[model samples]
Target chain A: MNSNMKFSRKTEELVNVFQFLKKKEIEFGCTDRQKMEIDLCVEEVFMNMVRHNSTAKNKIQISVNKTADNKIIISLIDHEDHPFDITKTDDLDLEDYVEKKKSGGLGIHLIKQMMDEISFEHQRGISKITMVKNI
Target chain B: MLTIEKINDNEWKFSGRFDASQADKATKELADPSGTVTIDMAGLDYISSMGLSVLVNTYKHLNEQGFSLRLTNLNRHVRDIFKYTRLEQVFDIVDPTS
Candidate 1:
């Protein structure tokens, strides 16, 4: 609750959006290792949002706020009835690519593994996902 | 996060963190090593599955081209990553950097 960064975008903007978000995280003093993990994971989640909402016209709101304990909390808010929690995707055999890779499940799995905590919110016609990590 | 030093005769030494974030351009550069190439990962910190995928893909491509792919300077961390993926048997993992 110390601070926040908000962004609005359509699905098309997600392609290279991770690069920008990653740079911003670095600016906030996230360690390089944490930055790399968060950057990769955040990109995956954003990419998922875009894919799931192919016809999404609403701009997503992403906020990054610092917690009292000097941690970073990230939230992605949308207005779609996305059925899955997205944090529960199963792991993949890192060996298989073409078959398993096309599914694109690794990103979510990796995110789940890297982040300390990931949770989603769905109420009042808004879907919000927040990821927290102690930096 | 990886360091590259061009050894004489077009060989290059690679060391440091080579993860998904660091693979794209490194893959491109490694794919075309300019000549016989050697990668030294003794100082490698850690690598992701994506990193290994990149290395395996490059290895396949290089093998087809009849180009010599020299792998040396493997630290314990790098070796463990390869071992986990069973890539230890696929690519040449050498110790002697010479």
Candidate 2:
């Protein structure tokens, strides 16, 4: 089964999306660790959208699907005109000490590390980010 | 969903989820520290990048004032986030039960 949802570009709406993903993970027989990883990836992407496009009153669309090979796919689409390819973000220097480390790029770094695969696309004035995890 | 309990003047216990929604409040509560500050994370279920950022900032601030920040009782999941972010080397983390 596949599910899709739309919510305003507000951080408060993230709770709803998280709850929905948790319920779907259970239905897909995902373990707790898998569910948590997916939740973290979703939150990182959604927060990036909110922080970058906060001035625009756009809606974000999220969809979840399970592939035949037991892969969980999640897609996030936003109407923000600017394209942000998270894959191209600066590599987090994990070796940096806390006094010198920059947290700005940490979220995307976590998402990249947790997800099996991640891709970004911008077309027709819309940006979409897709992430997949094996259950 | 974050709770900060004062164990003493230099120690505090943090419980619950420390996500984006709670980052601001957690930062405000963690602003001040004395010579040494210990944060108990045994009851913490989850912590996101936002929370980690806050903690990092707090660690820097405390260090600047000749203070130290320590964390104890990190569950497996919480420890994993720190390890993934490479924050394990940045702070003084101790396993109180070990």
Candidate 3:
């Protein structure tokens, strides 16, 4: 089964996304570890969209699908025009000291490390990011 | 929702979601404490990048004042987050039982 949802750019809407994912995890037979990773990935993607397009009128759409190969795929679509491919972002130097490390890239870094594969596409004034994880 | 409980002069217990929504409040509640601050995270099951940034900034602020920060009772998931981000090298994460 696949699930789809639309949410505003407000941070408060994250609760609904989390709840939706939790229910999907149970139905998809996701392990606790897989659930945690997926949760973090969703939070990072959703929060990034919220922060970047806080003033935009377009709503974000999220879809989750489970494949026959025991893989979970999540897609996040936003209507904002600015081009951004999180998969192409540079990795943060995880070894840097706390005072010297930059915080800007950590969110994307965590998402990259947690998910098995990520793909991004921009077309017709929309940005679509798809993340896949094997269960 | 997030709740912060002041246990003492330099100790606090945090519970609930520590994500973007609660980042500001959590930072404010944990601010301006003296000495080595110990944060109890047993009840905190979730944290996001915003929460991590708050913790890093707090650690820096306290260190400049000759103080330190300690985190305890992190669940396996949180621990994995730290490990993934290499935050385990920066924060003093300890066992709750110890």
Model 1, which residues run further than 4 Å from truth? A1-27, A93-103, B1-98
Per-model DockQ against the true two-chain complex: 0.11, 0.60, 0.66
Q: In model 3, where do residues sit more than 4 Å from their true spots?
A: A97-99, B96-98
List iRMS (one decimal) for every candidate: 6.4, 1.3, 1.5
Task: Order the candidate numbers by DockQ, best to worst.
Answer: 3, 2, 1
In model 3, what is the error at residue B78, expressed in angstroms? 0.8
lDDT of 3 by residue, A17-134 (tens): 9988998999999988898789888999999998887779888999998999999999999987786788888767666644474455778988888889999999998999999998
State each model's CA lDDT, in order.
0.64, 0.85, 0.85
Q: In candidate 1, what are the lDDT values of residues A1-135, reduced to their tens digit?
A: 323344345434543455456656766778766765666566566656766876767777667766679777888777786645786565656566432323235456566667899998789778888998888
Clashing pairs for predicted structure model 2, backbone only? none
Per-residue accuracy of model 2 over A1-135 as CA lDDT, tens digit each: 449988788877877888889888988999878877888889889999999888877689999999999999999999877778898887776666444866667888889889999999999989999999988
Model 1 residue A77 distance off true place after TM-score fit, in angstroms: 1.5
The predicted structure with the larger TM-score, 1 or 2, is 2
Task: Name the top DockQ candidate.
Answer: 3
How many pairs of residues in model 2 come into backbone collision?
Answer: 0
Per-model TM-score, in order, reads 0.56, 0.94, 0.94
